[model samples]
Target: MIKNIQRTLIELANIHRFVMRFYREVFMPPYEFKEIIRQCYVVGWKSLPLISLTGFITGVVFTNQSRPSLAEFGATSWLPALISIAIIRALAPLVTALIASGKVGSQIGAELGSMKVTEQIDAMEVSGTNPFKFLVVSRVLATTISIPILSFYTAAVGLFGAFLSVNQNENTSFRVYFDQVFDAVTFLDMFSLVLKAVVFGFTIGIVGCYQGYHSSKGTEGVGRAANWAVVMSMFLVFVEEILIVQIIQAMRA
Candidate 1:
């Protein structure tokens, strides 16, 4: 157990160094605009359908589950406001990031790990092409930008789904439901959620790229990289969520 703990600590230290290197390289000259755009398209556009579906189901399920308890307390009318706050402040960002970790994170790891094992990365180095810039930076940037947009999309779709669910059980009008929801949502709520999304996005991208870029020399390593990418990204998302919540609370106090 001690050995395992030591190994984990070493790996974390290495990851910190990798993050520092990424920050340095990302801001250096010769920005890869086209590559970044392509990655954004792949990460954002391709992930939308899945995000929408997940958010809709989450809203429907959450509404259904909470409705009974609220009804018991004669507070069913509070559904919209409750659901909106939950989704915006936590559910949408967390769920969306987890999905992206499994989808985009795994894809990044597998792609880069395969390249590593096949000597493609080495070939790029030999050919004087900056593989790190072309691959890692672009992907990280794409994820950073895409996640916030996806969070907004998820919140919107989730509210829509909540509307549908609420209408089925009650006679709440759309405008009134939203007025209740939006009235409760402060600018702090939106800003904090977006900030969380950005952090989650960065964690996913950096973890995925780090795993893939440093993959061992075998096909099995590619699978391991993908697995690690998803696992680490998800873990970091939860950790980040806790930290952000504490920070927000402290700020409020």
Candidate 2:
């Protein structure tokens, strides 16, 4: 048990060092603008369809499930406000991060692990190229920029889905439903959404890159790296969500 704990601690320390190095290299000279843009296209644009689908489905299901409970208290009219607040502040960010973990995280890990296994990364180093700066920095920076944009898109789509669900039973117009949603959400709520997305994005990128870059030397190791990337990214997302929520609550209080 002690050995296991010590190993975990060591791994955590290594990950911290990796992250610090990433921060230092990310801002150094010779920014890879072309690579960053390509990564952004791959991460951001390629992810929209999945994120949109998840958001819409989440909104529909949440609205349908919550209606009965609200009806019990004669608060059925509060559906839009309730769903909007929940989706914007929590559900959308969490769901989007998880989805990105499965999609973007896995891709990054597999790609890098493959490169590492085949020694392409080593060849890049021999050719006077900083592979870490070119590959890891661009991908992580792209994730950091992409997730917040995806979160905003998810919130908008989710609210629309909620509106449609509410309209099935009542005659709430788009303007009225949106007004309720906007009224329920404050600046604090918006700030929380952005903050969570940024943290989650960073977590996903760093964990994915760390796992891939340090993958063992085999085909099996590549698979392991991809799997670990997704699992660790999702785990970190929840941990980060908890900490951010606490901090936000304290600030509000």
**What lDDT does model 2 reach?**
0.93
Question: Model-by-model lDDT, in order?
Answer: 0.93, 0.93
> Candidate 1 clashing pairs?
none
What TM-score do all the candidates reach, one by one?
0.96, 0.97
lDDT of 2 by residue, 107-129 (tens): 99999999999999999999999
User: What's each prediction's clash count?
Assistant: 0, 0
State the displacement of the C-alpha of residue 151, model 2, in Å, after optimal TM-score superposition: 0.6
Q: Flag clash pairs in model 2.
A: none
